[model samples]
Target: MDLGIAGLRVVVTAGASGIGLEIARAFAKEGARVVVCDVDAPALDALDSGLAGHVCDVSDRAAVDRFMHAALADLGGLDVLVNNAGIAGPTGRVDQIAPEDWDRTLAVDITGHFNVTRLAVPALKASANPSIIGLSSAAGRFGFPLRSPYAASKWAVVGFIKSLAMELGEFGIRANAILPGAVDGPRIRSVFEHKARERNQSVEEVQAQVLATTSLKRLIPPQHLATVAVFLASPLGASISGQAISVDGDTQMLV
Candidate 1:
């Protein structure tokens, strides 16, 4: 399926690695001109030549400003913005989590979306088929035990994306959120490790418990999310807005 996004201008946050990297690569595969920003300089340097990369921490407004300027210049304009940057946050009881950790999570997960979108909107407004895709999580829809900070920030992401859909609809810029559950990656492994340590259990036990909540009992691939994002940004998904689409194989809970 040609998503009909060839030559589309796009920017993806934290696109140097993990899910974000897959998104950038997917867009590039569909022939979209892609620019990605990440805080890790080494990762940025290692990105595929097809995808331009820059160093920027989305939590820092100044850094986002610089990245957006550079990225838009490279793309000549913007048609899509993929807000995929986020952190696992601290895994522990609400009382056990530190105030700083909570603040940081919100800053990057929610505020970071605001930071990038505000800058990308003007460019997006000029496009004929503009769209915004935010990477929310299953935790956003369900309460996650021992992951209060992550859950709170992800939930905020849904609200943010829904509000953006309403606010930007007049400009033909659609906005939606993708809620993935337990994506297969080092990040999820680390999250499992943290949860296991917190619950005095092994990583395998925690991983199994998490998968058990899903009907398919499996971890989601980053490419699956990339496919949904590309479709949403294409003309084929013009009517899809204000939606919290789940790519998680029928996940029932966050475990």
Candidate 2:
């Protein structure tokens, strides 16, 4: 399927590596004119020549402002905004987690979405087929233990998208969130490692316990999320909005 997104203007946050990188690559593969922003300067420098990149920390409003200006200039305009930046946050019980950690998690995970979306909205409104895709998580839909900050931030993403869908519907802008499960990556591995040490268990045991919650008993591929994001932003998904679509492997819960 063509997905019919050739020449589409797109901006992806934190697109220098991991899931964000995969989504950026996917859009580029589909022939979209893409620009990505990340805090990692080296990763930005390493991005494919076909895709433009800038350094920006989404949690900082001023930084996001600068990034959006540069990205919009590169793309000439925008049709899609992929808010894929987030952090794992500190893993611990609610009372045990530091206040700073909690604040920082919400700052990057949820506030960052607002920082970018607010700037991208004007450009998106001008497009013929504008769409906003937010990267939530399975934790957004479930009560995750020892991961309260991350869970709370993701849940906010769903609420944010849902409200955007309603508010932007008249402008023909579609807003939706993609909830991913334990994705296969170094980030997840680090998360597992942290959890294991926190619980005094082996990494393998923690990993197995997490996978056991999913009917498929597997971690999600970043490419799978990229594909769904592309489809959602394409003309094929014109009628889809205000939905939190899960790309998890039939995940029953977050362990």
Candidate 3:
């Protein structure tokens, strides 16, 4: 099927590894000109051929503008912006969370979304088909006790997308969010590691507990999420606007 995304100029933040890298790969495979940005220089260096990337700290607004402008210039024009850069801040109850951790989480997971989108909106408006894709989490739709900060950051992303969708719809642009659960990765393992240490359980125990909630009983592949993202950016997904779709394996039973 023609996704109508071939030859489109696209930017994917945090495309060095994990889900972000998978998203970038999907677009590259579909023949789109992909520009990736990430803090991991080594990962950027290891990207597949034809994929251009730059070292960028999404937390830094100045670096974001410079990277986006350079990449856009190289790609000729930008039509899709994937705000996939994020961090899982320290796990703790609201009362136990430190102010510093909260601020850092908000900066990258939330403000980083704003920084890139704020810079990319102009180019998006100019495109015939413009789309903004955010990688939110199932936590974005609900609250979990030990993840107040991370939950807040993801929730903020949903609000950001909804408001931006309304404001940019006049300019023929669409915004959407993907909420995934337990995507198999080392980063996810770290999330459980922290939890295990905090709650006095082995990492195996935490992983088992979380996996039990998923009806599918397996880890979600980044490729699955990447496929969905590609569809959203294509003409096939023109009507999928301002919606947060869950990519979880029934891990989150959203209302």
Candidate 4:
């Protein structure tokens, strides 16, 4: 199905690895002119998808603005902006969480999105079908007990997208957030390990408990979320805005 995304100019933050990398590949596969940014210089250099890559730290406003100018010039204009940069944040009880850790999490997860979106809006407005896709988490919907910082940041993403959708709707710019649950990756494995240590359970036990919350009883592939992101950037998702779409396998809760 022609998703109608071909030739579109796209930029994805933190797109050198993990879910962001997969999303960048998806857009490139659909013939979009993709530009990706990451703090990992080696990963950016090694990206084999034939898309543009830049070293960018999304949490830094000046760095984000620099990336925006370069990316927009490379692609000539922008049709989509994928806000996928974030950290797992410190895993600990509220009292145990360090002040610096909380600040860092919010900096990357929430302010990072702001840094990118505000700069990309002007270019997005130039496109006939513009989109802003945020990578939120299931924790945004279901509060995570031991992951207060992560949950708070993700919930802020949802709120950000909603407000953006309303503000940009008249300009034909669609804004949406995707909520992923238990995606299979090193990142998630690390999260499970942290949860296990926090709960005083084995890693296997933590994994089992997490899977039990999903009706599918399996980890979601990063490609699944990538596919949805591409769809949202396509004409097929023309009217999908201000919505938090879950790509989880019917996850019941975060606990």
Candidate 5:
């Protein structure tokens, strides 16, 4: 089905790899002019999307401002903003986590979204159909053991989007968050390994236990999120806002 977002200008953070990259590609496929930013300069340069890429650290307000200028200049305006840049953060007990680690995690996972969305607001207001899609996680809904920093940050993202929906709705802009659970990728493998070590279980066992929480008992792919991103930015999602949609095969909880 045509999403009716062709020619729209979209910006995706950390779009050089993983879920972010897939979201950018999905927008490009939908005929939207896409711009992506990542701190990984080499990865940004190597991206095959043929769209504009910038080296940006979303946690840095100045860097985000610069990126917004460049991206807005390239696209003339913005229709969609995908705040997808995030870190897995330290996986350990809260008491074991360093103060710096907690601060850094919150900066990237939560503050980064604020930086980008603040800069993108003006351009978004000018669009006929503006949308802001944020990346949260299933951990945002349920607490995760040994993942306090990550969980806290992801939960903050949900709050941010909810507030943004109310603030931007007056301007005809929509805001929502996507909560993914145990996505299939290197990142999740790393997470599973950490959980295994922490729980004294095998990686396979830890992964199975995590999957068992979901009705599908499967790991979701980055593309699953990409599809949702596309749908949320399209006309079909015209009235959808302030919703925290989970793409985790119907996650029941986190164990």
Candidate 6:
């Protein structure tokens, strides 16, 4: 099916690696001009030659605004914004987490979404069809041990998109959230190792325990999440707004 994203200008945050990189590649495949910004300059340069990239730290407001302007200027205008940059901060009990860790995680995960959306709102509104897709997680839908900060930040992302849907709807702008389950990626592996060490268990043991809770009994790939993202940005998804859809392989039932 033609997603109708051809020639459209799309911006994806944290597009250096993992799901972000896959999403950028998928957008390029759909014939949309993709602008990917990440702090990892080397990684960004390594992406497919067609991708337009910039060195950006989403947590920094000034840098984010500059990147947004550059993306808009380069793309000539913006039609879609993917607020995908986020961090799963130091994993630990709520009381064990440092103040700085909490602040830093929240800054990048939640506030960064706000920063990019705020700068791109006018451009999105000006487009004939505009959309915003936020990358939340299964943790956003449910509580878990040793992931307090991550859960909090992801939950806030959901709130941000829902509120934006209400405010942007009248202007023909759509906002939605994609919540993925335990995706198999470097970041998640790192988190698993951290959890194993923290909990005095083997890495395999912890991983097995986590997978057992999911209905799919396996990890999700970045491409799996990217496909949904592409759809949300496409003209076919114009009627989808304020919805929190999952790519979790049916991990948990939602109301």
Provide the overall lDDT of each model, using Cα atoms, as 2-decimal numbers: 0.94, 0.95, 0.90, 0.94, 0.93, 0.90
User: Highest lDDT, which number?
Assistant: 2
Comparison by lDDT, 1 against 6, better one: 1
lDDT of 6 by residue, 99-137 (tens): 999999999999999999999999988898799999998
84-124 per-residue lDDT for model 5 (tens digits): 99998987788999999999999999999999998899999
The parts of candidate 6 lying over 4 Å away from their true place are 253-255
Runs with alpha carbons beyond 4 Å of true place in candidate 4: none
lDDT for each residue of candidate 4 in 64-149, tens digit (9 for 90 to 100): 98999999999999999999999999877899999999999999999999999999999898999999999999998998987899
What TM-score does candidate 4 reach?
0.98
Ranking by lDDT: 2, 4, 1, 5, 3, 6
Of the two candidates 2 and 5, the one with more favorable TM-score, higher being better, is 2
User: Which tens-of-lDDT digit does each residue in 1-255 have in candidate 2?
Assistant: 889999999999999999999999999999999999998999999999798999999999999999999999888999999999999998778999999999999999999999999999999999999999999999999999889999999999999999999999999999999999999999999988988997899999999999999999888989999999999999999999999999999998887
lDDT of 6 at 228: 93
For all candidates, the clash counts are 0, 0, 0, 0, 0, 0
Instruction: Write the number of the candidate with greater TM-score, choosing between 4 and 6.
Output: 4
Clashing pairs in 3: none
Q: By the TM-score metric, which is better: model 3 or model 5?
A: 5
By TM-score, who's the top model here?
2
lDDT per residue, candidate 3, 43-124, as tens digits? 9989888889999988898899899889879988889999999998877678988999999999999999999999899889
Residue 181 of candidate 4: its Cα lDDT? 93
The TM-score between candidate 2 and the true structure equals 0.98
Give the C-alpha lDDT of model 4. Answer: 0.94
